[model samples]
Target chain A: MMIKLETKSLREAYGLCLVELGKRNKNVVVLEADLGKSTRTVLFKEAFPDRFFEMGIAEQNMASTAAGFALAGKIPFYNSFAVFASGRAFDQIRNSICIPKLKVRICGSSCGLSDFGDGKTHQSVEDVAILRAIPNMTILSPADAVETVMMMEAMLDVDGPVYIRINRNDLPIVTPENEPYKIGKIWELRKGKDIAVFATGYMVKKALEAAEELSREGIEVRVLNVSTIKPLDTKAVISHSKGVKGIVTVEEHSVIGGLGSAIAEALRKEAHPPIEFIGIQDKFGTSAKNYEELLEAYGLTSKAIADAVRGMAGR
Target chain B: MEAEKVKELKKVALKLRSNVLEMVGVGKAGHLGGSSSLAEITAVLYFHKMRLNPKDPKDPKRDRFLLSKGHAVLIQYAALVELGYFPREELKKVKTLEGLLQGHPDMKTPGIEAVTGSLGQGLSIANGMALALRLEKNPARVYVIMGDGELSEGQLWEAAMASANFKVDNLVGIVDYNRIQATGPIKEVFDTGDIPAKWKSFGWHVIEIDGHDIPQIAKALDEAETVKGKPTVIIAHTVKGKGFSFAENSAAYHNAALTEELYKQAQEELRKQGELL
Candidate 1:
């Protein structure tokens, strides 16, 4: 089977989806912390001027204000860089939003070392781990642009707090456009019998590519898209690992308390194969000229994943 | 303000003080200083100024009051008990695992609009509610009370800038200017100089009044409602423990366990105040 090579920007898709959500629901409001242009929420600001709140550079205030909006029967989507959204305003999100369980959607754009030029200060490789520790928080990591739009639509129907991690660059469209996205469900992008590869966000595309590479070497590899990082689909994880030689977990984040840790915790009690984690190995990202350079430096490429699978297959 | 209404509100404030003592009990630690300081303001807002329904706490068109200085929640709980938001018996069970009330403001409580206790976040929540009400064309208003010492948090200034920038006229902020914190006085700790001047420069309609005076609190609230194009901040000058003889102006009583003698003495002071009224 041949895979399409088309690509689209997740940030641009998020902006367009906010405009559509605003039109569908009058109570849909957007809050930005002076990163509207970078996060693409300026599109929503242009469309619904009355509903858009420019909160300056104050992420803590923006978070609590979103809680207030939710209290008054409005669906608010607050945007900022992943580091500022999850790290700088963690307390506000914990006490004001998650503790009370308000209907506030937090969008952390340029997540997981995607903002390559800004270095460690702007990049967020631990957002999922930090947010997952808090109760009543639903974490969403869309595989591509199509899934970003679908997740935003699904967030409106969710009752409690949600944090959606979006990448900076245009990613290959991996998910189907017509299928409705569910909150705690995993999608199998490719199937095999020898090894199972669990991936999320930008890594899903890399996982698919790696599976195709392994297919040529007579080694079958299965690829699963674990989009919902929190409240993970453990049953699917366990069942997919069945009859496989080993499992490989991939993400654009740290190996600690992320998709890898989530899977490891899930299978600790159940009967499963050995697992290998592929991510930032507890190290800060450095300033790079481009995204591919950073991915290569961090060993987050199709070749690296294929090598891991081949090692698991004992080749 | 009518003299009869003033008398009635004063009685409500006195009752709130009595309720605070009951909630604190004789041995357990509670925020007596801040709770006592907010009694009159809480009474005036819940009984006279804000539009609310105890039976239907989630009414879409009702006014909102958030305790940004949530350690003073005993006074709000006292007012809520009187208004029948919860049972009066629950006052004795505050800060207990089986009770509806917690040490901080939680949404689990029937009348709490936001979960607060970590200081300096309530004003922003009030601003959000104000913005939402304006967009929906709802005539309801939002009120938040902050501690003077809570001004030490940088997030409070961030929220102040946001409320002004958004022109949230439907929101009103009150600072319990007791000038004392957990450790010591505001001047010795973190002094926010010239309170009214600070808020006025931030684009809020500034109002200063004696927090214990019922008529003054009522008049300031009425004045805040008429202001447009900006939010209002009423800096209510107050003593830390206004009603009690031993606890007045004392930071030691801020969150101390009352002795059996002090408990009886607090009740006696309230009784004498009631007789004078």
Candidate 2:
């Protein structure tokens, strides 16, 4: 199944979505912690200056304030870099937002290794891990611009707390522009019987590419895009894993407590074949000159994913 | 405030203390010292200061109250039951499985504004409510009661700075300055020296008051409404475990399961205090 690949950055998609939300809902407000320009929340700020809040580098304050706004009958979209949003304000998000199940949207921009040149401090490989530990938090990791926009559209109707992670650079559009978005539902892009590559975020596109490359060698890779990391589409993951010779999980995050770990946990009781995880090993990342170099250095490339799948498939 | 009103408020405060004691006994493991410290301030707000209707807890025009130091939620639970937010029977089932109340302030419990248990989070929430109220053009105000030791949490200072920067004049933060925390004195655990000056420097209208003094608590709240262009922080110098002699200023009672004998002693203390009031 071929889909037209449009080129649009996730950050740009986020900015446009905010403007769309601004026009549609008066109760929607956006808050940022002094990185609005980099995070692309400046678009929302310009359109809804009255509703936009510049929290000035205070991520923790932004989180609780968003919680407060939720209490006062307003849906708040609080934005920050992934590390700051998830790591710095974990307590606030956990206590104020998750515990109460407030209607707040926390978007962590430049997640994973997307902020490639900035080194490990800005990269948030553990954002999902930390947030997953908190109860009542729905984690949504959009694969591309289309999914990001759709996720933003879906956030308005989400009654509980949500964290939507976005990438910094342009990721090839994998999901169709007209594809209906559903939280915790897997999007199966390719059909195969030999192996299933469960991937998330930017790695979804990589998985698709790896599957395409593996088609030459007749590996018959089944690609599953695990968008909503938490409230994970476990049924989809398990059902697709049935009868497959092997399963390979790919992500731009730590293999310790990420999508790989979540899938492994879900499949623990069920009888399944061996699985291989292709992500950053348990090690700190250094400042990379480019994202491509970072991906290659971390073994987070299509070749590496294909290599893992080949090993899983015994070929 | 009139003398009769002050006397009546003190009587209500004593009743609230009794209610806290009863609730804590039911919950088995609850913050006795911290909850007792805020009884008078909580009583003053619910009975005399904040405009609230128990029947309409979600009233748009009603004032909002948030217990920032949420571990000390037993007293707030007491006041809520008295105000008819929930039936009195619910109070007896606190801390039990499937109970209406939990150890901390949860929105699941009626009349709770924000669910706060982790420290340094309530002020930012109050600031959010203040901004929302101002945006909606509602005349309602927000009241947040925090613990003294909770001030050491960096997020509170962030909220304090943001509140001042945003001019959240409709928000009033009352620090239950009981000095004593779970381990020991706040000065010993993590000293935030010069509490009033810290709040003042954060651009809040700082007011020092005897938090246990019902009339003075009422007066500080009244003064909060008159302040313009900034939020107000009432550094309420309260005694930890006020009205309960054995528990007063004792960190052991901060979050203790009262023995049957201690519970009886607490009831007697409240009984004697009620007579004095």
Candidate 3:
């Protein structure tokens, strides 16, 4: 039942989705902090010049300015690197955006190890840990380009603040086209009873790959994409993982506060089960030749997930 | 321009100062030093310059005022109540739990264009409103009041540069350069050397004026409107805690409340200022 889908970068989908949204609603405004080329908001700026704003190298100002636009009845989407958008402007986003519950959608690009060439400063490995503590903030980490578009559309209907972390590299489009995506909902891609492989963002692809590898060895594995990191759907996570022997959470982010921590927090009061975490382990990333090398160095590949799955299932 | 009108604006300024004393004195914990510094600036706008209506605070054509230095929200609250944006009785409950007035300015209250208190963020929001209005070809102007100490935030510099680059001529920024910070003088705590030149280098039309003077404040605002193709910033030299002699230029009064005896004494001095105006 595998569908042959084209591979495209999430940033490409993010840019095109904004262009489409700009056409759909004139109230849709895009603001970029001197990263239109990398963030791909240039597509939106080229399409709708009037609605696009070039804020220039100021992430904090860009966030608060977006809040002003939101207050003036415009849906503003501001973008920058995850490290800057979520880290440097943490206070601005908390007070100016989240405290007032302004409808400013913050898209943090080059998340985790995605910006491998630029090194640790560009790669944001702990954005979820930093943002989840803020009140009235919704966090979404899309798995692929298609889901990125769907989440962008979903945020327009939402009234409060929403942060979506986008990957840098192109990934395979795994989700079925035209599939409805909602905030705080899980998408069960492959079902099995032996062990659950919970993943998010780029790691969802890694989890699916690990599931196929485990399937060849007669160890049935279940894979779930928890896109909405905040307001974790504990019910779906627990129900789908009821009879599984163990669980291994995979993410492109840090193991402390990303998908692994979310799953652990959800299963806190549940029955006996061992949970394994796979991500950047409580440390900074390094400048690498490619993202693949960084992933392998950080133990964030499909083989790492597969090994964790087998170890958790006591194989 | 008229002497009688200047007297009236001064009267509003004195009354607003008294109201800040009453509200913050009742609230027992409010920003007195910075709030006092912004009294004349807020009065010059609400009473003389800005085009607004108490009945229709959200009128699209109305000029906007944002208090970026949100800790001094009592001054703005006094002006809003004077304009009848809300009931005068609400002033008595300032900063109380579940009160209409909070420690900082919030959009929940009418006439508050944006929620601000976190310093160095208001100018950017004001610039954003200017951008939106410019796109609509609307002639509405946006005014933001920022503290001198608030300029320590890097966001303010970024916003200043962006607003000028965008040619947001309809936006005006007024700095209450009261020469003091929350702890001490701005020079001792992250001083921004020569603010007027700093703003000028950012491509803004800069003006220096006595902040407490009514006619000068009004005339500066008018002059700002005539300058085309760029935003304008008025650097007003003001004293922290102007009216009361004991609180003047005292950092201890930055957030400290006055005692009952001192409160009555300050009220007497303020009543004299009111009568003189």
Candidate 4:
């Protein structure tokens, strides 16, 4: 499949989705924790001021309020940093949202290495891992701007609690705007027999790039963009890894309980292979010059992934 | 709604209290003191105040109740069982795996509005529910019960501020001021001075009452309904344990398994009051 080019930044994509969400449903309420502009919910707030709320810096209260809105028959989309959404307000999310199975969407913007130099405080490399432990939660990480729009639209249909992790930086548009948005379905971008690369969020494009690089070196690398982390496409993973040399899971989160852990769990009791996890190794991140350097330092680059794949393939 | 009904409600409250004691005494792991303290208030809400339908637990028009201090779930569970939300026999299964009644209230169980164990969160969730009801133009009121010790959480103040800002008159909060937390007195753990005055200052309609008095609890609920354009807070002064002289005002009974001798003694006392089943 060819990568489609749709020019839209992450912020702009979020703004567009907010606008669409605002127009499509009156019950749709947007909440921000002092980052309405950063999370790109300002446009929706301007249009639907009555529906949008600025809950100050209290992410915990913001989560509780969103759960409240859901109980009141409204679709509340709460925007906050991934760390605060998953760490600071975790109890609120688990209790108010997940326990009742309220239709609350916690949109965690500025996730993983997206914080760049803001360092460990802003970077949420372990959020996905933590949230996955909670029952009745739908975890999702879209690849790019188009994927973000698709996921935002798709979230309206998902009942119970939905958690979406996003980043601050722009990513290459890897999927076409017209791509069918079927959440929980993995899209196999490239097929090969050497190694199956499972990647999510901003790292999907990198995995595809690594696949291309490995293919030129006489290695058939299958690249899969695992969009929906929860309700994981286990069948896709199994078929994609059929007779493959090994499995390499890549993500922008901690390697502990992120995408790699999910894939490893699925492959553990089955036809398993040499598994390599590409993520932050159980440590806090730092303030870097840019997201690119942060990604490279965290071993999230295409070259790093390619090298890992080469090693797994015994090259 | 009548004198006879009030008498029946009081009887129900006593029965609820007895059921609470039996469950906690059997489980040997529950906030018995707090549960006993809030029994009458729970009865008043379930039996007289709130328009809840056990037959239609999911009735969208039904009132909502959130138990913020969920450690005292035996109180809420006892009331729920008596109200026919679940089998009255299920009360005996408290804290057991087969029982829907977990250590805390769960929404998965019938009549439980939300999952609560962590304190200082119920009021905010209540505020949100009230705000949502107001936004949807729903007439159903949202009620929440909080422990006096739960006021120590800073998030409670945030909820207080948000409730006033939203002007959620449909929300009613009741604080069971039993004057005891887990270890000891609430004053030692945290000082949230002047509970009623604090809520009043936050723009809420404040009512204080003897929580064990059914008529007083009823009057306070009636007064809260009249306070327009703002939410209401009822401060019920209650003993840690009531009806049982041995456990009354005793923090050690906060959670204690009643031995066979103690259970028999408590049962005899409850039977004399015509409360024991």
Candidate 5:
């Protein structure tokens, strides 16, 4: 029998969390680049009209302005589409925010292929890769609404600049609600000895599903949720990789510089099992009728992940 | 302004030039042209305008200044050194690995509001600070200096619109209109026509003045603080390499090593200017 799971919108959670954070901290301000409604920062605008800045389709200005706000002892969160946030305003984010080590939180909403209808122009597959190269940047990718709220809170305590990727859809509520979130600690959702699966963002749900599928086939698959991409928990990754027959790294980002590469770099110095990367194989996303169709077309489904594990497990 | 104050500020300007020469040293390329162009403006801001305490450089209520045209940072370093933000001895170690002063403005150095070597970014940061200060009901103001050639950056225009849209009256922007850039003349390279008109059309309170004139610089800054709803931009027309006769209006000196002979000549010129003041 197939068990049903509940889903929650990460954007909604983000909006509600911002309102709560605003009420608690008067210094918390929000800046948006004419995508408030889409990014859900509009909710913050309605609640704290005085603190919200309408930067008007200018991501570069918004990013640098957010740096200014940080310099003045305010915690500024600037939001834009992932492509523009990480690509168009890259120089501002690098020179103004990261280089100075400001207390600014950059929210790249609708990251990955979650914006399936918009196609390659709007989707951001290389944001992680591009941001990872910058110094003094903390990268976060939450799996579900619960994790999004947790990550948002955790971002407040971080001393330096942070980049958090948010998906466009309501994903499966996989992360536990009561558990406290740590910035760089890896979350192991399942215990197994046969195969290890490291996943992040919405792909964490897929990895859990793949684990269940592999379990029925008598393959014990371990699923690890890697929410923090930069300052990666390499110790946990190395410790978990030991004794497992093989490993499968999954993300909704480019396979080149995403979680797979991070895990590969972590285990390079240590003796570990062989690894398989399950992500977009160096391809831009195309328009699809729905999100699931794009995920399936790109071989990002549970079945494909299970197949990778099975192939690596030699079953 | 009193004659005594004017003479004092001109002397400060001359000292800033001398310090720039010291930092660049002989036979080592540095941003002598832009840095010299900003000598008078930096002298006025550091000595007359801008509330700063060297002991408490990060004072929350203190006025903020950012060099958007950060290549001209040698002048700012001179001002900071005079203000005792750091030891004057650090001037000799600029651009060195262990030096406190860098080739551009960095937060690692004292009293720098933001990292702003890359052009077109400092104005937006100033706007952000203005908005925050207004939100907090703080009376502190923000000032940013931009190069005329630096205005070619698209982000600068974006920030221009934002500052006016937000009505950042507490923020002031001064363009070091030296009319020269790294490669050549801004007019020949990439002319941004009608500079004053462009700023006025952007809804700023525009003021044009001789940047080297200390009294005019002080008056424009005073006028900016009284403007109620819009930000102000002072277009301070200046000569590139103002103090050094050999480098004046010459792009070659924009960032070039000063030979020992030329460096001595530059110092002698600044000393003469100081005597006249």
Candidate 6:
């Protein structure tokens, strides 16, 4: 009854996770805010109809309901868009889940311009910042389908409330099939010296590309993929950026309170290094015809990282 | 409920009331009126009703209690202290920095079930806890105390609907119908007339009683235990600042602090009622 991580699409990965959760744990429940199909938790409803709760578009109620389910000894994985999950249910997430430290995993897809065509109203670049502000909240922005599956499994092991931001777009598989995904640890994709490229969520892929582009210019860039945003791997971030002359942080989220800010805070405490942040600069993203255009508009591209790294390197 | 037990419970309730006022007086901060109104209900649940193991607050089989009207957490803290969850001396720690006692109920504290202060969210947490208990086939009841004014939150009804739909018989919701909210009378702010009827319409077994009546409150809870299907809602009519004269029925005390003179007046009033243990 092992449901392999069958789907590469983020939506499909969600469905697979729910189906696996239903088979293994009877206490595992799914809560949807009338966006079952969109969030891909409809798969759980199909499998364990009795355990699934359809809270009907009220994101706040859905969040607290998940907390209720957790109090009842059921592992509840809630699903909604990032905006609805974080914004519409900010108080609920803070008070009911984070403050109480409930074992609830909030699976918010379409984060950080994943809704390319949906524009500013749908894109949720602020979720990471908002969730990070709350104490005892674990935030994860998985890179691709593989990472999503890994985090979905990792969530069962981690105790307390977790916010797993999954991008709507399907990312190219980066981790080898056998590579174990550990929570609160960074993945050193490529080793280099002069500049360290710290990236998170979907930006990890762009970071790899940026590193390759910089390597051609003899500016050896080290790529570190940080999926776990909270309970951050401060040890790895500081160690990696230790001797590096310049550090470049990249994220699909706002420069405020996302990966860049987190890395800066850690760096500020340990050692001050010349750090250049390549992310959405304290502004909302516009609706573009496609995801690539949205990234370009926000300057969250490999070229942007490359330019930032080169600038910090004084090239 | 026997008269002696009823009298004992009333005494505990009054002590809890005094503790809440004392904490506010110490911290020089708190929701005085809301806490006073909720003291009796908190007393009935923590001291005499709910099955909680103070030694193991996270006991799986234990009944659950959530304070949805979390701003009045001073009342809950008072009950927790009197129930021996923590030392009675902790009463002085209210609103202090680096202390477990915060202005709002926080689950991080040893005995608190959920961190509640933002209105209209506690019942959902209780409902989830109750649903989980039922799924585990355990017979532990989950009690959630909400302010009457909190009914303005649509999620309360959503939780109510879900509880009855799931037939969560082990879930009990008690609304402290103190008739006053932050601004003024609840009727003037938002009238939720015939609350008992409203709960009944939502498919719950609704019971109406005086929130300050210890015997009636205990009896109503006992009656809920016999109900085979559906959840129960006890609309307990209460007086804001029940034992304190100056704060009573006054909306300003919802989160107001007592003056030194007022604190002495409140203590004198509690002494006169013979409720001081």
lDDT of 4 by residue, A18-60 (tens): 7787798888888888888788889888898888877778888
Evaluated at residue B256, the lDDT of candidate 2 is 85
TM-score for each prediction?
Answer: 0.98, 0.96, 0.95, 0.93, 0.98, 0.90
Q: Candidate 3, chain A: TM-score?
A: 0.96
TM-score of chain B of each: 0.99, 0.97, 0.98, 0.95, 0.99, 0.95
Off by over 4 Å in 5: A1-7
Worst 10 residues of 1 chain A by lDDT: A1-10
Which stretches of candidate 2 lie above 4 Å from their native place?
A1-7, B259-261
**Fraction of true interface contacts that also occur in model 2:** 0.84
> Per-residue lDDT tens digits of candidate 1, residues B27-75?
9999999999999999899999889988999998889999999899998
Give one digit per residue, the lDDT tens place, for model 2 in B1-277.
8899888878877877888788788337878899888877887888888889889899988899888888988888889998889998987788889688988888888898888888889999998888988889999999998888888899999999999999899989989899988899988888889999898888889999988877788888888889999889899998898888888888988988888888998898888877776
Candidate 3 segments whose C-alpha is farther than 4 A from its true place:
A1-7
Cα deviation at A81, candidate 6, in Å, is 0.9
RMSD of each: 2.3, 2.4, 2.4, 2.8, 2.5, 3.0
Where's the lowest-lDDT run of ten residues in candidate 5 chain A?
A1-10
Candidates in order have lDDT scores of 0.92, 0.88, 0.88, 0.85, 0.92, 0.84
True-structure lDDT of candidate 5? 0.92
- TM-score-sorted candidate list, best first: 5, 1, 2, 3, 4, 6
Residues A184-267, candidate 6, lDDT per residue (tens digit)? Answer: 999998899888988987788898998898899899989888899898899888899878879999898888888888988887
The positional error of residue A287 in candidate 6, measured at the CA in angstroms, is: 3.4
Task: Give the per-residue lDDT of model 5 (tens digit) for B148-222.
Answer: 999999999999999999999999999999999999998899998999999999999999999999999999999
Per-model chain A TM: 0.97, 0.97, 0.96, 0.96, 0.97, 0.97
What is the per-residue lDDT of model 1 for residues A210-310, given as tens digits with 9 covering 90 to 100?
A: 99989999999999999998888989988997899999999999999899999999898888888999999999888899998999999999999999999
**Candidate 3, position A205, lDDT:** 90
